[model samples]
Target: MLRRQARERREFLYRKSLEDKRNAIQDKKDKLKRALDENKIIPTELRKDALYLQSQLEFDDKGAEGVTTYIDDEYKWVGVDDPKIMVTTSHDPSSKLKQFAKEMKLMFPNSQRLNRGNHEMKALIAACRANDVTDFIVLHEHRGQPDGMIISHLPYGPTAYFNLSNVVMRHDIPEVGTMSEAYPHLIFHNFSSRLGGRVKTILKSLFPVPKEDSKRVVTFANQDDFVSFRHHVYKKPDRKTVELTEVGPRFELKLYEIKLGTLDQADSADTEWRLHPYMNTAKKRKFL
Candidate 1:
């Protein structure tokens, strides 16, 4: 009985320590945020310490908005003219992932799932350069769910990394490919953070980049509590039969992070993007 009590006391102490550590971290972040909101400059000695917090704050403030790095500086329409996009999963040859890529290709006929030679980001970029491929999406999956994605734009770019949740496959939606769609509009909701930056990357791949600076906003929203994205198709009032066909974002993205280079710098980019590891569901939560 005494030993059990001692163990319980130790566990309580450990939990208390963890809670205190978390609270201290939160307090520091709150202080930094307040200072930023008030436009107060930190002392030089403290600036180094606040740099990380300031960076995170700045990241949140813009959330991939106004980032033009991905825009083609030379051709301006590398992927837009023909819109050749390549989709490939991680090196692990998961048949389901390959099929998912195929469905993605069917959804956008211009896109193709590379059967061979799509291992590293650098190799993918080289292949794209050779094949005139302008955009590419690399999906990192965990237990069949595409938890993360690396979106790259060609000919000088700003690649964007994204987090995906509640992913619904094309096959899951009944008669998805068989049903017809008439250019359904994209509905973005509550997309915060570098999501705007990533949105440009996605749009450039699917369509053409906007030529002029026009004040337009497409916020990402869908999740109940957090930011999300959804695709809605409404039947025209004049139509008797429901179009019987619809389309969605294919998958929702959180635009968790952004970077300046392409697959050429994938290693460092992965680190910056916090690349999700591929593993079973339980293992993923424990390690990845």
Candidate 2:
């Protein structure tokens, strides 16, 4: 009798466990269904409003065709003729700068910007400008010093200077005022001091310079300059290898730290420009 009772108790425990698992699965399915329904319903009204608003906006714009108003000054269009270069600088094949450049070109198809310029960028810029170049779209990040001694494998055309340290120091902004405040000291620590050492090591390993030490001193620049050097001067670190390290200015950091859930009407370039945080979400966040 005791054995039969024990057997019945065991059977009851097994059935209870099975029932709990079945209920849990059912609960999950119900939750998913509810979530899907909620998503579908929430977007439906928003979609209708957006479509109607967009059509109304189009009609308004069409109605004001060829009528120049005072408001037109605030909405000046960036003419499609600017010569811009889309630079992607990094050791990584899939860097954010590269992706941003690709997307930017897609969005503004008329910009005349290349990845990197050959030889002295200043010289190139001067030449391009003399030939009626109005604008340049370069990676703002590449405006600084690069990793290693040799800025790039590109050749410097005589008076061309490769090192951006010279330019950086010449900037009117103080260290405290610049983006250097946010990053660690490891970036610019040995930059000025070890410039000679780094250049020697890079040249010995990468390219065999025909000129003396003085010539080499003038040749070393930042990453983009280095890549340009390789392209125009040296022949070692191929076009694929040369890269700009930093992204855009730290202003993005300042803007990103704002905890506002909704943007104000005055906070944007246009009312038509909806805030799609997808790109921000896609970017790798260094800070929490």
Candidate 3:
């Protein structure tokens, strides 16, 4: 099993490298095609290969124009299969953290919470893989306050690390009602940038498709790089009016890092992106 996993990882990395090359070429082709269509000068860098690209463009069809990337492979089964998520807390978790993990489990349909009682990270991840878990989430806390989250996609990964803040669990909400178990509709706001799109894809894949009439809704609204999470259920009184009720367990997440490999490979895996809070313009720039 170990050998097979290692071989598969190598193959995945090889395909990802090829995908990068294809994306670069596709970008150049798009630029050349645009310049020609607008009757403008071809870019100096593309001039030498303009004829070659133009000839290749003739074979391009709308159906085959979309270039597939490694990301597509990672989430190929997203819509087809309801994701199987395994949620766990850090070792020796506090009672509050455990409660938070339980709330998280309830948030994602088809998810289960596991007690991380003295279990190693590698063993936990191995068990998840063997059980065909689609994603592994580890919740962390600082002095009993849930403060961090790590989301790792299985088989292979592009793990994302997030800092949690202002968490309000279910029981904490006044007069909170029973939680809905139906798959919830998702709302993503202000995820416009390239990195924002990548983050959106990771977060979006966590939920299964909801029915049109599903009353439950989950929202991730981004502003100045902090993503605020909200859960709600709505009811329509009159044809023109709708009433919304807030479900419990709302929080804010700030993405701080993303890795190209799973948690176990963190030591050697390439870092895709990381927050640089010490930069001169960090306070002025908004990533998402």
| lDDT by candidate, in order shown | 0.55, 0.30, 0.91
Flag the better candidate by lDDT, 1 or 3. 3
User: What is the C-alpha lDDT profile of model 2 across 10-50, one tens digit per residue?
Assistant: 56445545766756654544444454557744244344444
Off by over 4 Å in 2: 1-94, 140-288
What TM-score, computed on C-alpha atoms, does each candidate reach?
A: 0.54, 0.20, 0.94
* Model 3: ten consecutive residues of lowest lDDT: 277-286
How well is each residue in 153-220 modelled by candidate 3, as lDDT tens digits? 99799899999999999998887767898899999999998889999999999999999989999999
- Clash pairs (backbone) in predicted model 3: none
What order do you get sorting by TM-score, best first? 3, 1, 2
TM-score of 1: 0.54
Models ranked on lDDT: 3, 1, 2
Candidate 3 global CA lDDT score:
0.91
- Residues 167-223 of candidate 1 have per-residue lDDT tens digits of 776567765434222332334543343534345445535543332332222234534
